[model samples]
Target: MSREESAAQARLREAAAARIRAARPELADAYDLASAEGLLAVRARIAEDTAAPEHLAAVVIGRFDLASWARATCEFALGLDPEQAAAWRRSFTRTVFLAGNPDNLRERFSFAHFADDGSAAWTDPGPAADSAGLRRLLKLFDGPRPLPVRADTVVEIPPRAGRRPDRPPVHRELHIAASGCRVSDALVHLNHLLAEAVLDGLIRPGDTLTIRHAPRLTGLTDRFAALRVDTDPTLPGRLRAAAGLTEEALLVPHHRP
Candidate 1:
């Protein structure tokens, strides 16, 4: 790119970064905002729409860039007391998982959660075979009233046998304990985990992912909802098929200063 073109790109990135910082002040120190290439990629993703900075920040956070997420979380935590840091971490983690691409989520399932009223306003997916399975899995949390309790979901991805013989399997767990949270939120969190696992190259074709969700309730038996998903090679292909992109495209090579 020419100097003038580069300068203009830099200016655009700076404006976007400033807007993001203004909206999400806690993410002001996020390394992604400081990255020229990262900002360029974010810009390219939303090139068609004149989205607000809050929406832009949501895109960045929902990108599931592990390195950037970890760095921002650590840096922000360093400035807070232990208790506050822990609380912030929980909130940040939930935001990262819940802020995923809504289009992708809608393609698979129909879901909605109203935070103000803690009321469920969602319909199950169509009567397809896969949708039937999903409906059955979600039945564990079915109740007349919203449960005011916490639920922990554990996702276990076994390491690819031949590719990474020495690398260990990835095991991740997340908790949905916030006030006014609902089962739909947990489903979104799970969907983000599956997408992130594929993007991170932690999950491979033919691998079976074991997922379990245990709700904490008093005076109730500790019953956990368990399910396994067998991933095919086309799973990754389907995810990347969006926007006619074969793989994640970057405007430029990303590197930290």
Candidate 2:
């Protein structure tokens, strides 16, 4: 990458780091996850799962409604094939929708998954791994024959205010695009972990759980050096445009709903 390109990339990482630190301080401290790396990892993981004919499920719960967050997610889902836009819809949930209650302001999108048991689990709001989650959980199995269920039903996974994350569940990293744009690090890992839990049936529908996305950086060379600070020396926006990242939704917003 050119010096200008490198500088722009650094700026993009800075913006991603800052956003993650400010928004997800807990994960920021633990995982040190960054944006670009996280998004790419998730895209790769989802693509792998979707390519499989078997059903796989996962949940992405965060401070939703931010156009940036939505845009980034939409871009990732559509990353594999633009014309195959419907592929994500079919692989995960069939709809691109949001769910929440007035009491709780969280936007969540869930994909599909199967449990170790014979049951299946989807997204629902009730208790932490409540019957709703369990009901779907039970559906994963084939008493006689297994069938995929893509219900149009909408349910809310009740709010659980205090929760924590299990550290180092799996390896995760961030990869900066040739362009400067970045996503969230912990967020991407969290998505993968969610998939595992869903597959394991540890998280049933209607069951609420806690997740964290700590901001961090990895794979920097021992001789790595900081970028020169001249004329701001960073242009994440321009780089994002250069990279296809410009087409994504507004990720993190200034205010909360």
Candidate 3:
């Protein structure tokens, strides 16, 4: 590609990176962003080997919308059946992101994340003349059972009145089961939904967020812990830096920062 073409492609990546940094700057230090970059590099290598336009486009789209991929991961998990979800909870450990560059236009890329066991294996049919590389990733389980999520329904558990109710707020438990879905998938789905809700301004920074579920079979007490991220005003700036964006664009208020 010509130097001018490369420069144009870089500009497009910068723009997309800007959007992501603005949305979640605190994750700049997280390995997921770096892992995503590595995947993008791999896609580029595949593209160079094959010279496939369609493959390049697919790769770039996957990388450019990294957040969307994470969201998709949750959606996929949430749709699993109860039996499958429970099995996945015990078997899955790592969360992976896959990406590619489709058209070779400015190194554009896209990615999606999946939860899998550490030993899960994948095989790729090296770059096709018309494709990037045929990927055989770990297959995900089927969608969750047909259980409706009632957004307006609030299942209340009354606070215990005996203790120092005034000193420490009474804690009540809410039992929320996935709408006829697998337990593992429901947790992932809920995680992504909550993440998106926070990103979209629907869930405020300090608002109390809770996950209610039956402890008997959910196995969520441990899996759900990793999703906790304290939102700081400076987090967006950090995320921008992680994406190789200039820190000036973060624009967080000083008091909050």
Please tell me which predicted candidate would have the highest lDDT against the true structure.
1
Kindly report which residue stretches of model 2 are placed more than 4 angstroms away from their true locations once superposed: 31-257
The C-alpha RMSD in Å for every predicted model, in order, reads 21.0, 18.2, 19.8
Per-candidate TM equals 0.25, 0.21, 0.21
Cα-based RMSD of candidate 3:
19.8
lDDT of 1 by residue, 183-226 (tens): 34434333333333333343433232322223321111112121
Clashes of each: 0, 34, 36
**Lowest lDDT 10-residue stretch of candidate 1:** 237-246
Total colliding residue pairs, candidate 2: 34
Error of 3 at 8 (Å): 51
Which residue runs of candidate 3 sit more than 4 Å off their true CA positions? 1-135, 141-175, 184-188, 203-208, 214-257
Tell me how candidate 1 scores on lDDT: 0.31
Report the lDDT tens digits of candidate 2 across residue range 101-141.
Answer: 21222223242321212122233322223323323422221
